[model samples]
Target chain A: MSQIFHPSTNTLSKVSIVSVVLLLGGLGYGLLALNRSPYVARTKIPFDQPVPFSHKHHVAGLGIDCRYCHTTVERTASAGMPTTETCMSCHSMIWTNAPMLEPVRQSWATGKSLEWTRVHDLPGFVYFNHSIHVNKGIGCASCHGRVDQMPLVHQENTLYMEWCLDCHRHPEKHIRPRDKVFEMAYQPPANQLELGAKLVKEYKVQKLTDCYTCHR
Target chain B: MKRLPWLLLIGGSMLMMGCRQDMHDQPRFRLNAATDLFGDRRAARPLVQGTVARGMLKTDTALWSGKVGNKNVDQFPFPITREVIERGRDRYNIFCSPCHGLTGHGDGMIVSRGLKKPPSYHTDALREQSVGHIYNVITNGNGSMMSYASRIPMRDRWAITAYVRVLQQSQNVKVSELTAEERRKLEGAQ
Candidate 1:
């Protein structure tokens, strides 16, 4: 028998490739584990909106509901932005001729969305469902902070898996009416901790601590 | 050697899949839905589970109080109230009013634009639902709605529930107020 060997890839290059691959793999795993644990509060989201909508003016003064502009939030994937016409509905008739509000008025007349900058965006790899949280009795302030006070909305909470699981672990204490889903804390029923724990247990919230919850 | 990477990738994915339960069909929260819908027989036993009364299921009760150690709610550092409701209402109108309408009739402009309108709050099923149940819908949202859980507060979510109840009641109230004599008695004028 006669043996002939022909190699396209060099041994030296293959060894170098292996070493590089190992180094990269170690770095990726390290980052993965670091991100696994929750990071609290919004050291992340640089939230800013276009129109600078004021919850104080609308809610405190006019008595609007959180669902009004973010309409589809109760049943859809996005807690949708109000259509330009939605703003015009009232602004056109109510503020009808206000000079300062002309931009909003114009947007409504033209049918363009507000182009609001997302303040509390979790990663694309993350999965978030509003109906689940709303149904689970979670509030808005749990992630967005006290939005009523903000003239221009900012991401108040970190929205990490830890932030979400902490409450997923106990829904009743944090659970309240559907409207108050955005509340900062569980005030009513006095013993929020106790109540939250009760809801979690009652609902049997398990593996909320599991990685696949927020992670895809 | 060429197929080793493929084998490893497939193996790793299988391992990850094996660690988790079936989340795809997990029973989501629904109005007036039984706690046992998720099949936790132990948690479903008590006669009075809705209230804070504790009996056999001590662990679930602890989860209610935020004493579950590793797991807790992300509520404010305080309790929820009407103030929270007011704020939530403001946001809801700005965000939800377009589709849900002011009264939650699900007949917003979008519906008029040919989007499907939702059930009216005046419906008996929705009327019978709890405020907490409605809040869950608002936060996690329903069929077409998105999670305002990120934008609205938990307390304000409850407030919206309160308001929705008001709408429901207004639309379906007894629809028959009593006479002056009964009204006087109700007011304690006697």
Candidate 2:
């Protein structure tokens, strides 16, 4: 049994132990990075639609109010997608023959839905209501970002529980005046935290972090 | 038996590498999501023909139809308050001002972009028209104007009608109607 293991074997065993620890740590870090990446979080990635609709042209160029198209946003659970009639309301006259708007014309002619791709998709378990947020001093820009600037809309934030918790835990960081909820270019004022604190009380926004608040 | 635990460890971890989305996307049709139950694949079914929801009977000829006995009434169904005028102004800016213009001048952004320009709201003919007539025009299409009934609710339509009157009064104000301060400001600007 003498000299079954060489002197170098002792160094090899110690290095092997250290290498295993390093490998596991690297694996854990990679998983977390992957979890928050664009692949999983779907942030900053634009989706393909049947027709490329430009929010920039419609919202910023035309100065149309969000409520003009999303009519039920203030009262409904989901912010309503505009109907074909809403599209044709203007396109019927203005962009009558634009090749890009042919799908809209066809949808109007056929009385069929345009099947606009949903941009903000949360998990089914999370029960988010647009009206409640809109009424509670949470501006549309707070979550949707500068939609007036995006030709093709993309998610601005990770729709992760941690991201949601960050806002729910401290809503005073983002709350705005109720009148400015639909205003796209609304900037948080210099005294944003102070104003938000006053608005949080006036709007009666509860720091609802209970699991059932969203899960149910 | 010794190798079975190692095999289970590797297999269990491998399965979890790709997180299951079944929980994320539960088996339910979300709003506007596609469905196979209908020919159109629309989960939101259209209202059955002639089916009226509760409190939506809409039998008031004056309020809902903007007509009484086949004539556009001259009176507003509800009294126009200052708050109502403000609400009307807000709603008017959103939906009507696109084509009607901010000051009822029929020179809105859309009109500039080549939609048939609507008539100015300050004309004597329009000034004499009843509020109900304007309400009727909004409810039903008039000329190139599409029916806004689907977009504006009944109350909002009246509010907008009231606001249209405000715009009319604002543009056609008589020189004598202005206060000394307002008269000076108007003359100074010119």
lDDT of 1 by residue, A122-201 (tens): 55556777777665666766655666666666666556666677676655556665545755443567777776667666
Per-residue lDDT over A70-94 for candidate 2, one digit per residue giving the tens place of the 0 to 100 score: 8888888988888887887788888
Each candidate structure's TM-score, on Cα atoms with residue i matched to residue i, is: 0.45, 0.91
Task: State the fraction of real interface contacts model 2 keeps.
Answer: 0.57
Best by DockQ: 2
What local lDDT score does residue A77 receive in model 2, on the 0 to 100 scale?
A: 93
Report the CAPRI category for model 2.
medium
True contacts kept of each: 0.12, 0.57
Docking class of 1: incorrect
The C-alpha local distance difference test score for the whole of candidate 1 amounts to 0.60
> Alpha carbon lDDT of residue B13, candidate 2?
95
Cα lDDT tens digits for candidate 2, B72-169: 99999999999999999999999988888999999888888888889999899999999999999988878777788888889999999999999999
Instruction: Mark the 10 consecutive residues where model 2 chain A has the least summed lDDT.
Output: A110-119
Q: Report the Cα lDDT for residue B143, model 2.
A: 78
